[model samples]
Target: MCILVLNRASMTNEQYQSARLSRDSRFDGVFFVAVKTTGIFCRPICPANPPKEQNVEYFTNAHMALEAGYRPCLRCRPESAPNSWAWLGAETSFRRALTLIEQGALNQSSCEELSDRLGISSRYLRQLFKTHLGVSPKKYAQYHQLMFAKQLLHHSMLSISDIGFACGFNSTRRFNDAFKKTLNLTPSQLRRHGLDKEARNVVYLAYRGAYDWQSLLSFYQKRAINGIEKVTDTSYERYVEISGSLAWFKIFADHEGKQTVKIEFEMEDVTKLSTLLTTIRRVFDLDTDITAVESHLNGINHELIVHSGLRLPGVWSTWEAGVRAVLGQQVSVKAAIGQLNLLSESLDYRVSGQLVFPTPGVVSNADLSFLRMPQSRKDTLARLASHLREHCDDSPNNWLALKGIGPWTVNYALMRGQSEPDLFLSSDLIVKKIPKN
Candidate 1:
């Protein structure tokens, strides 16, 4: 194929230099530069040739990039980037704690469980948040609950009572009291409960920053399990299982104003809605502070661009991600990925219209050979998943006691599923074996 070339338009001096050099993708979600002359902000990895220096300016996010007079690049489509910061964001514990709190870890949970998840005492988790974020963990969690309630308030046409339940409040009276105290407004005042609106099933979700929607969508599209999920032009849908129940949710991105991306969700299983929303955010890596995360990670490995936008790719079910991890224990990434797909389709539950990965309870009793799985590894996956399904709720430290599941699987699941931030799998020998070149 013949190559075609285009002239440079406008970009910052530094950005033009970085683009020329193909610098890291860690800056994918951090900042974009809207060329004063051309009107496009791009991820560091954008393929367009370097623009004229001094014509560009940097922005904190894609939204900010647009607000500062630049449009999004068509090729890079910087919208759907996976969680931008590849670790290295500061105050790791705080972010991890924030993730857990958002997951409803504190809605009906005590400080001890939250603290234990952080591998710290309840006292320490509280002190850490107090010292850095100027709030207690419980108070922080309460703030999150209110913000979540605000999402339902602004998006869903559900009644204030339903909003309270969806946001994890135990009772409508409690929801009312908390709503008034937090927002100085009744939930009714915040809701959009018109008959027409509810008929369309519109519910808008609000978050703090401009997410790279295109970047995120593209990544998930490749890894999306065929029948289990959908990634459309306007929305994303997937499965989540929580507390012995399963549910499906769709996040629709319809409008944008101010600094927020409005996402609307429609859930099929109302009973686990609280947990479902929390998990969806984690699985999609929505609650992350992309700007801060991108900046810190970029500061470390300036050339980690290709892998910088690489997200932790949270899993919907612990048992499922764990088994995938186990099958990959001694294999290359490609081999592991292919084998995982085969295993899922071969033996997982599929009658639900969509193929739902069989839960721990359902698969624990399964015969390994039926999965066409390796004979040696069959019992290991079955038992480990079973142990987690049974003891994931046991008091602190039971994770370490599981027979075939070690730090790799446990930490991976906790970090991916529970959104535990500091749970790093840093010491795996196989991981260390990758050539440092």
Candidate 2:
């Protein structure tokens, strides 16, 4: 029953009817405007004929309209929201469940463990899924598996077995069965490259909408982690490490038609595709409705976005995000970057023109030689990194509680790394102080 109190912009009858009459970019993702007469819900930007004035009703989201029994609009395809990221939106328990599944949680654990982590019961979790996503959590996980397998078949020359293992399959039979169950085509049938094809060695991760190409590039280029991440004409290339293994990624915007961002990946560990893609999405904040976001910020009194929306900064990797947060405890970005460069040169692993992030094992095992600073600060950051290494599971709560890492650090890392939108750094000293009324 959670709902977001979105901004209510004063609109003219023309604008309102235009939005209701034909869903257009102005109202996109702002609200789920339902026509009482037609019994259908659509994005503000639907191109269909406008409904009668008296027949229109606006709900905060499609979820809300759906709860009230309105069916999705067929013409606009409201379900295919480009802004699934919903900038600065609330994070519901269902979203948390989806994130966990993307992290390989369902594959390794169960519904019980998921509920425990979210601080809810298994029954409650199931109820939430039924109410929100309309499918059981397991079914969603199955859909996710099929997606991974499909991507491999289309993008890489990996055998069905390699794709299966990379996507968390126990056996080729299970992978094949699951692929067939969700998509009628067998894994081999739908492959873009058949067996014995030369490896393209490239995979593209689809991000939902258009981006500020120059802005996104400039931000990373300035603070681009030395060897680990590099900016190219088409992408921002980087080294990614998951579960102690290494991978390579090239992230860029697809300028073909409307506009979309893409991640071109090259890796040997195919089983980690699901987790990798999920993490990448979270890190980059894809699935956002760019049309809706620009409107909301533009509507904010005094234009707070003008000051801060200079760039949509995304976390390159969780480990790197955490490390930066730790170093930046009370220091400026310049100061933090300086220290991390030293730390990077001293401890990080270098291969294939990408500097690998210093792993938890290294932080826990070695003394803080490069992290030289106040003894207390040194001990604090090391302890946090060590905790990650020892537990081998970097949960949100545990990640936040580390010393020198307050809500600011945790919020920055999570927003960048987990795509958690509700995390607004209201207390950031540099941010204009709006009284917390």
Candidate 3:
């Protein structure tokens, strides 16, 4: 029943052995080691003695290991390992499907509905997951929810009921049943042996390698919307709307040994926790494979090598990013901030001293003539809003088809809105300044 899901050639047995022997944190989530003798899977950094190579099997993800009948190791707590940023195969559809799943697409929707959103058949989608991940979509989703709940149990002070709802279970009874069935332990039992202190409204998100926090914070400082976002030297704070609830969250790097960013939030609705975490992970590019990205850029240029950890900061919402991109065209960053602040002030949705940006419907129907911008730009904003309101699609090509959005604007929107990593702004004035040897 063991599924050798990951491509074996990606890492040789010797490398995995070395990593496990040395208890290297770098390979913690890249691949899990399942011991045949003990029927348990562990993170690479597990403190237990290294199992004999012949007794070992590797999996690309925790779900695969679980499918092979290996229970998670309690010593290492594989649930807390940083996620593997590497995609298993070269299939773009698989990657997109994985992203959507991480965003809770499967929480309340069928595989068919997810397939429809991905523009593929359910059969093909299931096949793709099996081929690359060695599990069905439903199983994968279930594992993710359980793992998240486990992490919450270990890391947070939240009640078991709150954790269950946050992880997408229907009720406390169901959550308890799931915990008992899956882990052979009740939720309270797990909480009694939790690792961290009972910190309220806090979560630690992990990322591999050194994060260029200054670069990301500076980028956000320039484009920060008034009353919505604020960036300081060591922290970034923002008011976010999730499922109609307004909450403020702050993120700062954990200066301790763990390579993680700590996020703290104030909110009443616990169900939105999963969505909020996903959005924060995307916005910070936490899942980027820094090693691969650095290797790809190595020898390309000296500058690229110097700042290899520079991440493409993403926004909370596509509509917000699109609107900001439109306002930023042909204007200085400072001017764009001023304009956005003005727009926020004029909007009607105010909550907790923060003004929520207008929705596309409101912008499309409103008379934006008072904003002191040129008539052409105003008309373009209206048209963009209307187009966005009419269609839920947020692709770059779709934005490009609009009247005023050109390559730069489209690419900017894609980079920030969609968290696209490979995009480059060739036409950027700063990029143009780089000398071509």
**RMSD, each candidate, Å?**
11.0, 7.1, 3.4
Best by TM-score: 3
The RMSD (Cα, Å) of candidate 3 is 3.4
Better of 1 and 2 by lDDT: 2
Clashes of 1: 18
Residue-wise C-alpha lDDT for candidate 1, range 184-286, written one tens digit per residue: 5576765533223532334433333445566677756655665567787666787644554555667665355432344444555453565665566567665
lDDT of every predicted structure (CA atoms):
0.59, 0.65, 0.80
When 1 and 2 are scored with TM-score, the better candidate is: 2
Return the lDDT, model 2, position 332. 74
- Residue-level lDDT of model 2, residues 1-437, one tens digit each, is 11222343444555556555554454555566788987777777677776777888876455556556566664554544443543233247777777778667788778999999888999998887776556677766765565556656766766778888877788999999977655555877766333326435545543333456667676677777777778765567777776656788776666354434555676756667777776666555555555446656767754455543233577855566777777776777778878888777787665445568777777767667666567777876788778877775475556666766677777877766555556777767666455654
TM-score (all chains, Cα) for each model: 0.61, 0.71, 0.92
TM-score: model 3 vs. ground truth: 0.92
**Winner by lDDT:** 3
Of candidate 2, the 10-residue stretch with the lowest lDDT total is 1-10
